[model samples]
Target: MRGPLVVLLCCMVALGACRREAPQTGPVDPSGDGQVTISGDDLVIADLNWTPPPVRIEEGAEGDARARAAEALGDDDLHATPASAIPLYLALSAISGEERAAAAGLRRARIRLLALGTMALDEADTGDSIAGLRAAHEFAAVARFLAADDPDVLTYLQRVDESDRLWELNRAAERALDAGELGEDGGGALAGFRQAAALRPGQPRAMQGLAAVESALIRRAEVAGSEGDFQTAARWLAHAAEVRPGMQTVVDARQRIQRMRATRIQRLRDEGVAALPKINGVAQARQRLAEILTIAEPGDPVARDLRQRIDRAVHYGDFRPGQVFTDALEGGARGPQMVVLPHGGFMMGALPGDADAEDNERPRHAVRFERGFAMGVREITVGEFRRFVETTGYQSRAVRRGFSMAYDERTGNFLRRSNVDWRSDYAGAPAADTLPVLHVSARDAQAYADWLSAQSGRRYRLPSEAEFEYAFRNGTSERYPWGEGTPPQGSGNMTGALDRSPSGRRWGNAFAGYGDGHWGPAPVGSFRPNPWGVHDLEGNVSEWMGDCWHATYRRAPADGSAWINPGCRDQVIRGGSWASSPAQTRASWRALAQVDTTNARIGFRVVRDL
Candidate 1:
């Protein structure tokens, strides 16, 4: 019995195993009458992440679903879409979350929805965005942010399947918010206000901001004024007046300006002209007059008064017309015997008791000469002198071969052994016609005077000491030609007073201070001409007067004429030369050189009765 039972169980087990392993059959289709049978791989389950896993769509199912998804995505604002689609998109993403086959469908819906939401935001003109143009910008920005990590997401976002009607929803919302008709949180909306202000400066809102700052300044100024800080307030008000638009502000500022001016004028009056600062009252008054004229009526008395005051001030203390003379001769050439003197005068000698008075001026006297006499206008110009030399064939003493006395710096004294001729001394000099023939002794001066007298058929000789002094002192008793004081720079070329030295080693003696530091003669009239139109009077070259140097005034005559020593041979040099100091250039100053001594800086001027 056990064996039989075991065999039965084994048979049952075999039948169960056969049932599990064998293919199953089902009822056949009635129309076809074909039996239904399971195939080897029938009922295959796909590896999916969701329940009720994805089924392959019948032929056109995918295309239909894609079209629907695209249509949904066409909304400008997916966020404004029917809330029902949200769950559908969420569900699709979850269902195809892990299956590559379902991913395309899920991704298409997501991208379309995202694109719509971005379009909605853009249409809102997030920051005062221009209606049509800026909306696209906002849309693009949002779209970019959403698809940042997806390479192909942008392609789907650009699709515009529907009329983008969702954009109208956003636009309506933006307009409502702008008009204050909506209760939307304005923090996001405020961005547009700021952007608009930035794009268009000085708009209502920008102007308001500027006005706030300006008003604050105005208030501060008013507070300062109320606190008795008028000056500070005035400054602030002045600035406000510049930028303030109202005529009232400008008028107030002008009043303040006028008040300040009046106060200044009162202060000046109290201080007196000398004590007051050297402000130009006339100029200030004129400026005020100009300002008044701008607001004054044409025939107003105040305007008339201001005009008269300006005219009077302009003419106040002005110098009267004076005379300045020039040579009447054409080309300003020195005529054969004619002379022209620019008008001026000088002191004839030292004061009676002046400490350093020289013996010759013991009886100090005042002398004056008014008439500007005709004298040789310039040291005979080279052209004129050359004609004389050419016509007369007169050989100048300077051309005669002989050594003359010249200062030697090495020896600190005069040296007499050098052979310096005029031609060699003045190398490359212009023709002698224009050059005052230099290297001529006093004898030469007299000889030239004699020759000129004969040529012009008129008396022309060296001026006497008195005549020369009178000629030099044109009409005044001042120390120098210009005035009683030392001459100013440019008054004449002379050795500077400051450069004078007592060592006698300096170029020219301290006595030779007039010609600006030149030891030898400069071209005639190179220095500033004397007021009397004389050149080289206070420097350049000493003149050869017709008088001898007198040790005392014991026998001097009082007449304005030369007083010559009965037995004196050497001629007097009345006016100091470039080789003398300021003190020696005085009208009465005197020196002596041998009558026959000839060298540069010893030229002479002649005197002729007008």
Candidate 2:
């Protein structure tokens, strides 16, 4: 009756006639759904080109099927009835094989799925949503198979998938919000709404949820402000403003928090000032200043002045024990920062039964340090020393003398090479910027300290011999800082397994079975720190102390002061250099160097009074 029906009927007739033709001479190919044949001595193709007519129910019967499907879905009550009615419609589809059958099947599946999804969303039940979505998908797949290119079927299936996803995200978001896991740090209802909005743009419910979250954050800010946590309150209001700008509540909260913050800062400032006068020592004063810094706004003059007074107290060793500082030098250069050693008493010389202990370290006597002082965390580095030279045009003793004690790896001996200075590589090898600055004399080190003191407006000098020994011992009576062990793994950088290279070959001796993975002086802090949090205190280089060289401690000061002699020619050098043997690197080992002498194996670190 229609154009498509007429074409289908004609094609069926033509295919039926073609099916009667017999094969002429070749075997038949029956590997497909259609059949092959030979027609009157000519080749005939398969019958696949013909279209089959669709089975259909009578009009009254179709009306009955549709009504039954609707009743089974229970659309009026939004509840699913027994699925026994599904098979009835499926049997009808098998008999009819019609496009309308497929459409009916899709409609029934969509209705049940939508109803179930509605229930899940309204009740906020995730399990029911999943079950309904899976059932709908099965029906949708069958409908697609029946009418693979049906536009209405494709559209309805898309809607079903979107509904499933929207409800799932909504449920999750609601749960997070209920658990109080949302807002500024981000784990709540706000995140869920954003996901939903991304899925279905312009969604009214998602937008409403976002607005609710913003309002809640604003309220939290008000509560925090009332509790005197003005900083936290401001942070919350800022998060709200970010969500929705130009809110009157946020503007009002900002003003209120600012007023509260100023009053609170002033009260804290006064409290800190009153606490300062009551602080009897450097330790108490430092504690009070640290508290003031916590609440004080940046660049507040009261906080700044309080910090200055605290620094003065530390300078005279009036501050607390265990304080550390970063004393900036000229050109804003900083090295490894300093740490304050606790004021206490310990044996100042070598321990008993130390075979490596020299005569100079004998007659061990008790040394008491009443005032705590700060020491460098690491040795002075090349970069830090270079900054001083570049800023002040200052020359080191090695540079002025045009030569220093350098090692000749080729000959395996120490030699005074011409034109050799601090910049020269260890025995003519290139050195990194982080290695300790070597070839510096005692006077040259003092000059660096003077430069630092001028730049920082504070006192900086080398630690005295007693201070060096006390800090090295770190409250231990053992031979070494880490107890009695043969230079265990990761100890201070010394001549080790890796020292068989160019300059290392020249090193007289090295620790057997110990490898620090470096040939010469490694970078400052390259090895592990000592017990006192100080790095390379025993090995990188023999550090020069403020005290002059003394063969023995017969008349040494017991007050932890430098034992300087006006006419002394050599300065006390502690902490054996990299070129020294393991025995020479012992804690009790000591050496001496001319005050104006420079050597690649010698350098120094500074200490500030605290």
Candidate 3:
């Protein structure tokens, strides 16, 4: 080290002319010796021994030297170089007065040497020993040239020692392997890992290297088995087996691989079947149906029928297709329908304090619809209604009368109004074609129903209040079609205050505060559909029922059918309109309007026999 230090000092003095001005005072004295000494212009080489020589730069060679240094630093793959190359370059640069070049060379050389040394220790390969020794000598020489105060030089010296220690560990691992203390797979992997660990033992990656080697060997064996090289595969497997004895999982895996090679398809099929749970009867049928549906072509009759059967079963609480009921109703918007109601009976009526609950909804009578029926899934869309009107020249009550009831906030009531028609109101709106016809009166709904019946040659009409309720209730006798709770906002575009209002006289002001105080009707079904798949059952508009609005339930029919009153002029509207409040939307809630009365908030979904 002292010999290298003297050499470095000589080089620094020789390269003094090309050396840049030192950024700080003479070398820092960590020993606090209070001695001021100078070896060359702005260069103080101190404390020789283990230290290496400084990188030197001769006059006029500064530019070329810096360029060479940059080039060396840029070689990312220099790790393949022998570590000795790094220190050798540093010593040469010092002698040649090319300090910058020497620094770059040394940096690359050190990194590569460290990597090599670490790898050598891990693999226990003596191939890197010569290079490692050379790199150590070179580093020591450069350390001597660096100012005694330069922490960088001291750090490099410490790194050299650490590299040596790793090398020693690698040597010990090699010795162990040679002594038969470790098997080929395990010993070889361990030797490599131990070397990496010695260099950076605290890093988890050091252990990962060992694992990676094991994985590679395993994969090679698997590949051999896949290629029909059974013997080679067995040999690889045997190596692994020797390394990890008593590992039943590995043994089983090897056996399985052999079996797969013997009977690939059968083995796969057996495994697949074994993985499936034992299913029976209805479950098996359901599973088959699901599989068929997944791969079935769209519009396939069989698939469609199967899907409908499934829906019917789910609705009626019966897995048997024949068990579900079906009746014919002239197709309204949706073609040919069936009525399917839940089997259970429900206590239909106003609870303790239902605001809009009338005497008719009292006694909370137990009423039941024996079967679930599939009614028209959707209300007649504008396009369908338009076709009916065009084909029959049937003028809707709203259009014929040229006016409809709209809630007027200023008047605190619904008033006769005209500016908007269904076509105009929903013009340019997306999905308008599928939206239920709005701004139609009870008369219009009836006419459309009549027209549909006539065209289809089947009976079609507004559902009786009971039928409507049954359909709306779906199966659950909850407050709403969905369940027994207030629906979230936007479930339907009804007046917010109406939905928020409690049932009673206090709630009567809903019409006045319609639109949540904004006052206007929103498009039909601009909210969540009921569980039964019916939309706008409540909120968007009050739907006209076939029955007349009665003052009480004195003689109301228990059957799920309409109780029509021939003498009545005012048609009954169930399911409160957008202008009405939540109380008005209750199952027992009712409203009355002249048969010819048309309103923006009044629209209806038709019912058919099925």
| Candidate 3 per-residue C-alpha lDDT over 427-514 given as tens digits, one digit per residue, 9 for 90 to 100 | 2122365556667777778888887777766567887777777766666656655444555555665555443422221244443333
lDDT string, candidate 2, 22-97, tens digits: 2121221223111112223331121212122333446557657556655654532211222323433554555554
- Residue runs of model 3 more than 4 Å from their true location after superposition: 1-340, 353-356, 407-413, 418-435, 481-486, 497-525
Candidate 3 worst ten-residue window by lDDT? 34-43
Candidate 2 stretches with Cα past 4 Å from truth are 1-323, 503-508
- TM-score on alpha carbons, each prediction: 0.39, 0.49, 0.41
**Can you tell me which runs of candidate 1 are displaced by over 4 Å?**
1-337, 340-347, 366-372, 380-386, 398-401, 407-413, 417-436, 482-486, 497-519, 555-559, 565-567
Top candidate when judged by TM-score against the true structure: 2
After aligning candidate 2 to the native by TM-score, how far in Å is the CA of 504 from where it should be?
8.0
Local accuracy of candidate 1 as per-residue lDDT tens digits, 107-128: 5544654444344333222222
